[model samples]
Target chain A: MSFPITLTVNGSAREILLDDPRVTLLDLLRERLDLTGSKKGCDRGQCGACTVLVDGRRVNSCLALAVSLDGAEVVTIEGLASGGELHPVQAAFLAHDGFQCGFCTPGQIMSAVGLLREGHAGDDPERVREGMSGNLCRCGAYQGITEAVLAAQGATARREDAA
Target chain B: MNRFEYVRAGSVAEAVAAGAAPGAAYLAAGTNLLDLMKGGLATPATLVDVTRIPGLSAIESLPDGSTRIGALVRNSDLAHDPGFAARYPAVAEALLAGASAQLRNAATTAGNLMQRTRCPYFYDPASACNKREAGAGCAAIGGATRLHAVLGFSASCIAVHPSDLCVPLAALGAEVEIEGPAGSRTVSLTAFHRLPGDAPERDTVLEPGELIVAVRLPPEAAGFAAHARYLKVRERTSYAFALVSAAAMLRLDGGRIAEARLALGGLALKPWRAEAAERLLAGRAPDAAAFREAAEAALEGARPSGEATAFKIELARRIAVRALERALAGTPERVPALPASPFSAPLANPLPSSGAIAHA
Candidate 1:
């Protein structure tokens, strides 16, 4: 049976019309809404390519049912930018050269942004590695990815001070 | 993944009522369940999504001094909670040791406990797995089992319970509060996870329609004195399932072992407690010899599947001993912390000190 779901996405309130009972938020975002920023790599939740923010927390949208998320807020990679300005984490990904194919870049950026906003920054590299361990890059670009996040932290601090 | 009827529950009792219906399952976080559904491993006719239900996601301390962890508490929130990090450091460490920051941010506490094994055969539809199909013979017994269990193996199933939190919680004597059609009943954390005897299909003793509200941990002196370690040895250093992991809590009086609680992960059908090994450490002086003996006693009955993986027993033993030693040493040395990014700096290599080995 088709269920009515009202979800806010990328700072816009969306009233989606879904028919399939098995359709997930990831499917709706990509297929229905054309929010193709979130990749569908390894739909088994083993890969972080489908990560998005549901109620201010990073979730693998492939595993999140659309009907189950009624009246909830969802954030996709497309929403990370404000007035065409990339989020600090997204900018950092570009600065650090965090992607090769860029298939997993969106999810990685989303997860990193969520982590940084939640206050996981520290002087330790191991802590950062552990924090960002969820997103996997097949190109083995972890070294660059880590550097970008650290660099982003510095930039974010500067922005905070400037404001 | 299938055309299952989705029901958003309003209350815990209503959720349990719907769950009691045949082929109905509770959907919390949906990390594991949705993954299994997409993989064609599990197809429930009905899914009772409990996310909208009130009072199932709050983390509060009970009036009895016990900490009540709601079933829907996110893994990230639980790991970062000051009380959990302070009182149950092992639990926090284990949660962090499992998935990456992103997965934990969405994965729920109850979902973590209910996560299935990452066995290739169990995930593949064509492969024979008793857990997936009742009469299907296990392909893992003679096939690829490098990541399979070393302890608590039966002919039927050998896939280990994949939760890192339950191992420490089981060791610390936590109780699970479950409510169902028959009313509420509290099961000891030790008894919550069941060993795969003949029925590998049944992972826990929870009856149908029973929803777990919270996991209550009683305040004990032993729980506070508890020094714990969660050693996750995977193929890669980060974001990988454990090959063989151990969580050990050691209590010391001066320099002698007063009590020890040992639990093994990625090596059993359930979160396994090395009770026999712990019995060997009571009253013994916390030393290298004592640690070796305890490790040996715990791994005495272990039977490995292959020649390459037999070393896991020895590796698990050593890691267990070393982790306990480091946690008990009370060493003030702080390793360089890593940045929150994928690679902010180089990993500092710290060798395990022999003198720091505790009997527990």
Candidate 2:
């Protein structure tokens, strides 16, 4: 049987008709909503390539069934930039050379943003590495990724302090 | 995945009723359930989404100083909760050490306890796994037994319960509250998970259609919170299943062990509690000799399958001793500041001190 669900994606209301209850949030975003930024690397929860923010918390979109989340506010990688401006995390990734192939970059940036929001992106590099360990980059970009996250976290803290 | 009917349960009664249907399963975080379904290991015809059920996600403090953690409490929330961490550091650390950050954010308390084994044979439909299919035959008996159980394992199945939170929960003596068609009931955390006997498919003792409501920790466990430690040894530094893990809690009276609780994971089908070890440590001075004896007693009846798992018997003994020693040292306010190069350090050399226990 099919299930119907309504979600607020990227600060916009989305009403979708899901014909299958087994459709994952990753498939819904990629196939239905056309938000292809979230990659489907493993299709399992092991790889964090499909990481997204649900109600402002990081979760594996590949394992999240769309039908189960009726009114959740989902923020994919596409939702990060606003008004042609890159998010601090996205900009930091570019500045720190955090990606080689750019496949896991979306999930990495999303997870880093979530980590910063969760107050886990401390100044320590090991803590940042531990906090962002969910998203793996096969290109061996962990050093750059950790540096980018730390930089983004500092920028975020400075912005918050300015306000 | 199979075509299934979905029901978003609004109340506890509705969830139980929907779960009572044939081939129905309760869905919370869907971290394990969805993965199994996608792998064709599980084919539930109906999924009752209980994440929306009210009052099942709260973490409340009881009047007796004990904590009641609802089954729907996410692992990330529980681990990051400062109050819960201060009251139960071992449990919090175990949860943190289990899965990655994204997984912990989506995994629920009951779902972590209910997660199935990560045995490759179980995921392979062509393989003979009694746990996946009853009476199918045991393929993991002699194939890749490194991750298999070393204790309380029957010939039919040797899969270990891959849960880091359950190890500390077993040591804390938590009570699992359940809601079923009949009424609500509570069971000891140690008794909730069952050993793999002839019927390896049955992982838990809960009846069909029963749903976990909350897990309540006893008030006495609060006293041991300050002297608790959880140590997990795995193939990788993080985001890997435990090779051998130990959770230890000690209540000391002027260097004399007043009480002790020890539980081992990744070495048994279920979370293995060291009752014999606890008994040996009680009323004795917390010394290296006493700790060694307790560790030896904990692995008294352990039987490894092959050379691959033979290392675990020795590994578990050393890990248990280290966990107890750390617990006796008492809990630090926060994790010690890491050195500049934490990841570059070798994973094999977990023990830095060149003191006794050279094998570690």
Q: Identify the leading candidate in terms of DockQ.
A: 2
User: How many residue pairs clash in each candidate at the backbone level?
Assistant: 12, 0
lDDT of 2 at B263: 95
Model 2 lDDT per residue over A58-117, tens place: 999999999998899999999999989999999999999999999999999999989998
Model 1, span B56-134: residue lDDT tens = 7877876777788999998878878876667777777778777777778778888877788888889999889888888
lDDT of 2: 0.87
lDDT of 2 by residue, B197-277 (tens): 899899998887899999999998887887888888888778888888889999888869999999999987788888899
- How far in Å is the alpha carbon of B133 misplaced in model 2? 0.6
Runs of candidate 2 exceeding 4 Å displacement: B335-360
Candidate 1 local Cα displacement, residue A101, angstroms: 2.5
Evaluated on chain B only, what is the TM-score of candidate 1? Answer: 0.90
Question: What TM-score, computed on C-alpha atoms, does each candidate reach?
Answer: 0.92, 0.96
- What DockQ score does model 2 reach against the true complex? 0.73
| Per-residue lDDT of B84 in model 1 | 64
lDDT of 1 at A33: 95
**B-chain TM-score of model 2:** 0.94
